[model samples]
Target: MATEKLRQANTGIRSFWWWLQCIVSLLLTALLVMDRAEWIDVPGLQRLEWQAYDWRVRSTLDGQSDSSLAIIDIDERSLFEIGQWPWPRTTVAALIESLFTTYDADLLGVDIVFAEPEASHWQRHWENLVEEYPSLASLPPPTDGDQVLANTLSNYPVVLGYYFQSSVQAGDPPVIGQLPEQAHLTTDSLLSLPEPQRYTANLAILQNGALSAGFFDNPLVDADGVFRRVPMLQRWQGELYPGLPLAMLLALLGQPQIDPVIGEGSGVDQLEALDVGGFQIPVDADGSALVPWYGPRGHFEYISAADILEGRIEPGSLKGKILILGASAPGLMDLRSTPVGAVYPGPEINLGLLAGMLHQSFKAQPPWIQGFDLVNLCALGLIIVVIFPRLNAPLLMAVSGTLLLAAVGGNVWAWHQGWVLPVAGLVVLLLAQTLWHLSMNLLRETQQKRWVAEWFGQYVPPQLVKSMVESGESFGLEGEERELTVLFSDVRDFTAFSELLSPSELTRVMNRLLTPLTGAIHQHKGTIDKYMGDAVMAFWGAPLRDMKHADHAIEASFEMLAALERINREFVAEGKPTLAMGVGLNSGPMSVGNMGSGFRMAYTVMGDNVNLGSRLEGLTKVYGVSLIVSEATAKQAPDWCYRRLDQVRVKGRRAPLWILEPLGRWSTLSQERCTWHAAFETALDHYQAANFESAAQAFKELGEEDLTTQIYLARSEYFLKTPPPQNWDGVWMHTDK
Candidate 1:
């Protein structure tokens, strides 16, 4: 019959828990939906924190080192030295010639946009130079120069930079260059066609004609109108035009021909891997590769344009080097905002190209990455589903947290290794799984509480009884414990004080004092275990384990003492009697859990250890000490200095225990007090040795404020009043209860 009753009781408990979980689950679902819809405004400042996390991950993956891409800075110094903005094309041509002839640069790529013609005077000077010198004539002719600089461009390999004009204009045909025989054409070759191609005229006449041409457009858009990624290729007039980086790569690779393979009905355009001499180049859809930007900004090397113009740098420095000319000057309009910085980022597209050349780190979203992502998501989902149903609440929570961390770590690793995994999807999955488990757990716990209350409603506190039934544990509660320092504090004369006020008046007064005291306890992470009529029992290092429990408890005790002083001043002004309290602290192991029967229970500790702690609180009165602690607590608190009082056997304990007082404000102690303490210690030594006269004299010298002074004086007076019989030990017996 008893077994049957127990089984029925458990069944009812489970049912109640299930119902509670259902309600909690519904509430959680609502919250999740609201959050997803952004009905709740999560602070925008959180994005900065997220950015910090991203930076940490990036820093960890990429060693703290600058990139090798050098920037040829057209700084303010260059502007002042080179005669202001838009220095004549001849000056630009000189800058290029100096880099090529003196620096022996391998490739020269201009980041500047030459969208307009040079002045006629500058054009004529270039023509005169070409005519005066045959070698200058050998140089590519300028398209408008009397002798076009295009002649010089043709003699030496050069790549012209231009931007793609998406805007359509009427009455003019777009200019396009003839495709070299080696370059692949999507359609049959035709020298000229009437059909309009989508392109715009180049602003700068290619006086010195370029061997190859590339578009210098960076097309990246962010949620807040910021640029984070640069598109390498964009479609125009039914043809793919490569970005600046791609154009540079091609030029550096000896103007390699590009062959594109169109997959039949797959709608996937693939580039045939090409060999530029010995180097292999990979391109993605639209015949472009993602530029591997090392970071958000300033990853490229920069050289001041003044250094090149004023002969500060050797001209040979540019030899065999792919030199990019861009402005880093603040006054120049070339500055761009990027993810890593607000300052001018130079040109990230150019930086990406330089990075690609140095490390050969090309970006491509291969077909396999999509497959990997799908597999990862499905596997994660399966794991959550299988584990969520079988595990207990605590275990379920632990596993969920672990799995979430693992998933996040995996994503970070993939991203650091140049793979862009979908982080948002994994985060959503984890949230869903956690919410599902929480809903079920809440339902189960509620049902258990109801069953518990029904079984033991008459025997235990309702709160305790509910907790026992829900948790399904009689002794062990779902909590943690550590070596906590327990403190018990009580008013000195509550009985006499209470007799003067009615019950309501007494309660109000008690609450005023307890309010500040409780606030102090919580501030130090100590939980109030229980409260007697005039005493408070609280403990540290449970529910949440803090390694600094001893320190925290001691600090809280001192804070309470200070708060009482404030309270006393207020009470004095209000014509109420001031209050004083004695606090006792002890640190040791004690069984902390739910106690009492199922219907009514309490989260309390019960053991000899707890009794000893209470006894210590009572001992505080005997020693006339504001705060007293046991030897065990004093030993653990190395940071605090304490003076030992007396050793005494309390009412029940057979063994004697050492008592101590904290040395308050040791740094500020007056020299007189220090000397008095020395005298008190001497008296204590003499008293233990049965030298009553010497002990009495030493004790007499101590001031009234010295705590040990009174204890010593009392001992001496007692011995003098009734000299101890022979063989009587120095130990003093307490005559008072």
Candidate 2:
């Protein structure tokens, strides 16, 4: 990781990432936005939120059974003891009578609906016998069991349960039996709440006899079929009716009317909660409330119907407890999927809500919940735009984890305060943001590593390239001008030298010459531009900036001379002729960077100074010297002693430039050579001033082996013979490259 070049969203890439994040964030956020507006369905996100809520609900469960509520479950035991179900009305009446009169419970509810009158087959047989023989007609028609059950229900106002259907089936009655009292809330007033289309209710006698009735069916289950919420009231025929829990609660509180607490809006559109007997039963906009689960399902007291009939229950167990009669047997009772688990008893759902209402523990998901989701989404979007791009992968994960913990913590706290605010959308947004940042960072670094490998793989050493990559700065690949030193070198008389060896031998010779020379350049931080046969071209000052390009280039040139002497010794031992080469170096402003066609690219330097360096190399063979340099290179590297060379113009350019010959460092050169070089320069000055006699006499006395002294002596004698020019610059121009 330390070696990786992690690119931040710099100016060149910032706008691209901005729009990319916007597009991705918008696509994810739009689904929730449209869902909140009721214009689309985002079931996946909704399911995620539902599951999160379920986890919270489970984590806070009390895990203790409530003694205040009990169910008279018509389980298999009751079936075995009582003959069969659709139990005789006389027996049902006896059970009801026993619960209230004998056990003395505070309130009771029957989850079973008595939609039809009793069959009384035995009574019909008896009446038929009496009509046929006139023997049993006077037996008082078989005691009325339906009327008996009615009397029991009338004697004590027990809340009865019924159900509504969203769709009516074929051949089934659209409306059966008699419904309980309606709240008379018109459709115009509560348009958000559901309106019932059909119902299966209790008989007229039973309805008139009981305390009241309420619908038990929950139609607003989540898309995943979890019973997370149930409505408190639903609309029907321009009227609102209470749910079973509400009906039971109202009956327990002395039949108080349901006073809905609506907010500042039309049609009770902002339905917050239902006010019943001074209890604030909080609900959502659609008149629904999140189910307040006490614990896992079946966390309540249960007494068997057979036990009630056979008098097996403890006497005080049902004395003050509210009882609801329903079946718990698998095939007989209605089952529901809830947060706790699948296959939950339907009566338990009602009992859960009823208990919540009794304790006022119900939580409201009011109209503003949609607004809260929108706020979370918008907030995360801003974070994506402002903060995400700047963070690396690890930090993105950290931030996402922290936000999830905070959101879940805050949401659970809200739940405890009787409000349900969602954090699922927040989780989705965070995931999107974190993923975008991490993925993009990976891609950017991947491309950058490849780029470094392609451009500098051959020119720079591995460690140096690694350091450059780790610096994280942008490397401009386009050609740019920079001060650099260029070196050009080749074997003297290369054509004649190669003729002395076979092709294979020449290959080995060139390798011997170029290999160590290449090392010398790399050692002094120079770039090897290209090699042409026996000739080599190299430079310094890029793809990295070096303040000492001139110094380093001159140092490399000296190393090359030393390397050639070693090669010559190897040739002498192998019984071959010794060889020598000249190096030319020039430092000045030059174009240095990546340059090439589409097929290939190379890091190199090129300019007029680069060409001048090549010309100086050729001058070395003509002037009896092994090293030559331009004045610019000599000025920048002042520690080396140099001999003055004549000014001359190269073929390509009109400007005449001074060239110098590097002798040795000041610390290494002897006193005798320095004196002789100084004496020769004095004589050359007299010749350039047109004093030919003095310059010729000085050259004759010196008689040095240096080619420049001899060339000047011949030049001085010729100028004396033709000394008629009124103006002469003494600057020489060469026509050769």
The global C-alpha lDDT for each of the candidates, from Candidate 1 onward, is: 0.62, 0.80
What is the alpha-carbon lDDT for the whole of candidate 1? 0.62
Which regions of candidate 1 fall more than 4 Å away from where they truly are? 1-57, 60-69, 119-152, 167-204, 259-289, 368-375, 378-396, 432-454, 457-737
TM-score of each: 0.50, 0.65
**Which structure among the candidates has the greatest lDDT?**
2
- Writing each residue's lDDT as its tens digit, candidate 2 over 563-583 gives 999999999999888887988
With a 3 Å backbone cut-off (N, CA, C), the pairs that clash in candidate 2 are 189-267
Q: Residues 1-737, candidate 1, lDDT per residue (tens digit)?
A: 34345656676766565555445444544443444344663344235424543453345434333433466778888988887888766566666667767766666666766655554756778878877886886676555432244445555565666665444479655564332112333432211111223443234346236656666655444444434445455555445455566566777766555444333324643342234434444443434444455565555667887898778996565556566778877777777655455664455446655566456565444434444655665666666655564555777789888988888788677766655454554565567667777667666656556655654443234544544544445322423345777889998887787787799988998898887887787777676788787788888765445577777888889888888889889888987777778998888887665555656555566566667777777877877778888888888777776766877777667777777887754676678767766666787778878899998988887767765677778778898888888996665554333
**Model 2 — which ten-residue stretch has the worst lDDT?**
1-10
